[model samples]
Target: MDMREFAGSSFITVESLRAGPREEVVVSVAPGKYDKPVATFKSGDQLTLNKTNVRTLIKAYGEDSRDWVGCSIELSIGPTKYDGDQIESVVVKPISPPKPLAARTPVPKPPPPKNDMNDDAAAF
Candidate 1:
């Protein structure tokens, strides 16, 4: 059985930053592979993405786990070196968007047709 599952909370560290009198930000650090948190994949009853995978995803994405909450990273299996030994491992990669989002231009509305106003308009 893998142990990283149980080691999650153990290795993670949380820090609180005061931003205002009543506002604060909490930072949580989890086991990461590259420079990012390892991405966890849940199966029927198993979970994948170990420390290495988390680091790779962190590197592919970013170091801050909060920022990665809604981000996407691609993973692949490849050979990696560890302590002078080569072993197959999962790696995370960043995918570039086809194009950047462009600013939307508002459509010009046609000016109201010119018409004369009659004082009887209030009777309606």
Candidate 2:
């Protein structure tokens, strides 16, 4: 269950992921189309392709998060097709995760020592 932050604009390809037969690909989204994928499966409902057919799939997902926006793209094997070495490698750039929110409360500073009480210690 690997999670990534998708800003709603990233190119992806099956070759880059090295997908194999009977493998499943899972995509999870938030408010925006660009939310990072939430899960991936090897086969079954979560699976999109199988050993028999490979198709070229290119799609995007997008969503609006408050003031921020996001989306993503997915490319897979098409019918009667296999991405071999002949096909140029599609460069899929990695997405960076969002930063943590800022703390609401302020940190307190330590109190300073009293000068009068330290006067005797300094005299010694």
Candidate 3:
């Protein structure tokens, strides 16, 4: 089975989030919102956030998801230690607000010839 459909890339957006019953946090991963949808992740695909990723999210978007309604989270699958066994787990990368692009001046275009005739050729 493709793990990407679960959580394996930087194409997840915080659709809605809430603290789970215990230490877990339920996060709805919605692709195609902030980034392109890969594999098959619907609008409300469930993704239980790992503790490490959750803490990272809190660091980036703050604890309350109300402050992160439309924030982007870059996640990827990587090696992680779990229960003394090495395993591939969903990883969270640093997330920061996008910076503004530098303003560019519009290039001037040469005006079209007054007449539609070829400049080098005379009308016959």
Best by lDDT: 3
Question: C-alpha displacement of 23 in model 2, angstroms?
Answer: 1.8
| Full ranking by lDDT | 3, 1, 2
lDDT for position 22 in model 3: 12
State the lDDT of candidate 3 residue by residue for 28-65, as single tens digits: 43343334222222333445456666666556655444
TM, every model: 0.35, 0.17, 0.41
Candidate 3 local lDDT, residue 110 = 80
Alpha-carbon runs more than 4 Å astray in model 2:
1-12, 17-19, 25-27, 31-76, 79-124
Best by TM-score: 3
- What is each predicted model's overall lDDT from 0 to 1? 0.41, 0.30, 0.46
The 10 consecutive residues of candidate 3 with the worst lDDT sum are: 15-24
How much lDDT does candidate 2 score?
A: 0.30
Measured on C-alpha atoms, candidate 1 has an lDDT of: 0.41
